[model samples]
Target: MNLNRFCYFLLALAAAGSLFTPHPWVMWLLLVNMLTVVVYGGDKMAARKAWRRVPEITLLMFGLVGGWPGAIAGQQLFRHKTQKQPFKAYFIVSVILNISVLLAIYQLYPFSSFFTS
Candidate 1:
């Protein structure tokens, strides 16, 4: 499958797997964002070396899956994917989508709140 489809399928699988794991959101945010940062750096290196690059959709999908913070960091840190047409707009959409999903989860299952103490 293409990278875009793979990204979605990966997340769908993770989401389903998370059903039985406690506080999966925490794991997703921490791990995915770290992975996102590394991917951004990898993409930057690929660009400099003229090597195969990470797909733009994969980058955006990272944000869509709660990696926006890392995406922002990666952009600034690696100076990658910044000022690219359509990418910026799509990244914003992904961030919005992630936020919407977070809110929906908060309003959903009784134990979904991250702030639960």
Candidate 2:
């Protein structure tokens, strides 16, 4: 399959897998990521139409709250806000912060008991 299809397939598989996980947070993240993708697409369309546009802070908030995967995918697929100075810098920071928070949670609560009943 092509790159875009492959990316989408992976995302779909992740979402499906999250559905079967004991951790509710995984499902929540998948939902948030899907919403993020929609918002990013909306923002891109608005940009094209010279509309009022979605706020950058709103987009960043979505990314910070477990939607960075979708944010990255949107950036690549839509070619929106990929290289716009401080925005890109801030986006990178959000990705790093989100991952760090996940890692910290995993470290504090080890998966051995975290996912099991």
Q: Number of backbone collisions per candidate, in order?
A: 0, 0
Query: Per-residue alpha-carbon lDDT of model 1 for 1-117, expressed as tens digits?
Result: 654465557666656765556666666676677767877888899899998777897898788878899999999999998999799999988898889987887787565346332
The TM-score of predicted model 2 comes to 0.76
The local lDDT score (0 to 100) that residue 102 gets in candidate 2 is 83
Flag clash pairs in model 2. none
lDDT of each: 0.78, 0.78
Where is model 1 more than 4 Å wrong at Cα?
Answer: 1-22, 111-117
lDDT of 2 by residue, 12-94 (tens): 56567776778756676877788678778878998999876777877787788788998988888889989898988998899
Count of backbone collisions in candidate 1: 0
Task: Work out the TM-score per prediction.
Answer: 0.76, 0.76
